[model samples]
Target: MSLYGGMNTAQGSNSCLCDLRSDTMTAPDGAMRAAMAAAVVGDDVYGEDPTVTVLESRLATLLDKEAAVFMPTGTQSNLASLMAHCGRGDEIIVGDPYHIYCDEAAGASVLGGISMNAIATQANGAVSPADVTAAIKVDDPHYARSRLLCLENTVGGQVIPLDDMRAAARVAWDAGLFVHLDGARFFNAITALGCEAIELANYADSISICMSKGLGAPVGSVLVGSSALIMQARRNRKILGGSMRQAGVLAAAALHALDHNLPDLERDHANACALATALTEMGAGDIQLGSNMLFFTPRDKNPDALRIHMADAGIRIGGQSPAIRMVLHRDVTDDGLDATITAFQSYFTKE
Candidate 1:
């Protein structure tokens, strides 16, 4: 019963599984709901939504950007950013495993007529400056003009070292390319790196911050960058149908999360470390800890069987091939972590 004993949602029954799928599963708490209900509303399309303005401005200042725009999701936010940064027929240099290239449905190319020239990523998720330099296309008519370089922080839950990120950005800037960062887990990276928000932000021309991820906001992602770029993204947002009215309800939740959940992101990281330590000690296969996320392969090398066993034990995990990631977030408390370890114990130690 302790597996999901601390969950705060009514959507799940009295007896529920401890969900370790992703931080996206976190629900807005009572205080966040109250803030949403009490939020002031306006027409955001017309730029009159006060709460949304506050959220955008707060992030802009926090990241030392000239402006920020809120989007319904990080995917759209990144797409808008790519569109804003790259022109039609222009190319972007990004890591092959980055969310922009791998997960966002290649919207930059599909919708924006932009091309992604992917460079291989290291185990720690940092792209080499040499690869970036080599990936940039020549100024000839045959090649797509490389106009932007995209990077992600806390890729697979591991923080990209600050110096490495800066070096990559320097290569892009020297080549006259704009730098865009998929900062979906922005706060988690900062907590793990122990640096100020601007320190990680200074190198990128634009950063997409997703509040709904580990920050525990019900929904909202912010794109912070230069005012001119943001102005263009607003139009892109409208074209992409990301423009919202009376969206202060969602913005209010993000504002609340910034105050309460953002500071406590470290708790999730600690829990992840604990899980990794326990699983490693128990001879769990290749447990990799990344910030607040951990990746594990079943000892039996049967992910399907592991999924079944964990589910039977009141713990829910993803069924990703090779290895599955178990995320730690605000909703997953110490008790949930203990339950997860206990479930692993039963399976790995059995027979």
Candidate 2:
């Protein structure tokens, strides 16, 4: 099967097409591969992987954190952070649709025995301070102790405003809860808000950043936090079997992505906006544009039918109708974008 579940040519097809399924579909380019090939290797389990150390330190400095630790995936990174912050039977407040609650396989609860208090998120993807206030449990013995507040930026392709995030974090802090940010799309949020990484980091006690998404690394995520928190997360990482040996090759790709691919996110954002505008003009779908993602809902055609048509025309999309997410990445070209636009126009015109 294709890396993105059951989609694309991996389902026994021969078409090498434009894939809009997710930014996770991105592959490392030539320069990234070169960096990985030339990386000086060492055992990360012993804290001797220089490349990994550099990547962690760079991100820590950028986010203005005291320390950082690399993990195999964002799922593990976020889980380790949770395990470090809260003990068994403790509770964390999170948005109902956020990845930590809906996705991640409920790792926090399953592995750490941490309870999740899911609150309704606003349309803009921000959990209100009032919701945070309402969710915090008292010192009563009957309720799970609320120990953490988790927030995600660029949730479902919407950037939660910094002011909103600060307000939410303030609420969490006042309630004696630590804040964790699932910033898998951290750079996308940074580009959208035109803010420095440290500015965003100021609102959260810890952040989990995925390099394999828009950053275009082959694999790896990093958790950045205070030195004590990161040290605890490192121990949790080892316990979760996330500690690595000879991990510099993977870290090198992430380093290359930070140096090279991050600046191109603005282009991806522009492409997403352009595609959203085209779909809007064609009356093809209900479009919601967010940074580097576009949600398109077909107005006059079945979503499955549209999917097959696009696939036949050498384009791939994900999810079922009424809304399909199309993500722009460093790998998707302007020609691919034009071809995708043409494919949609042809399908709807024929209808």
TM-scores for the candidates:
0.95, 0.97
Across residues 9-96, which tens digit of lDDT does each residue of candidate 2 receive? 4543224467788898888888999999999989999899999999999999999999999999999999999999999999999999
Model 2, global lDDT: 0.91
lDDT string for model 1 (2-91, tens) is: 222224334352254577878888888889999999999899988899999999999999999999999999999999999998889999
| Model 2 error, position 303 (Å) | 1.0
Q: Report the lDDT of model 2 for residue 201.
A: 92
Using lDDT, give the best candidate's number: 2
Off by over 4 Å in 1: 1-15
lDDT of each: 0.89, 0.91
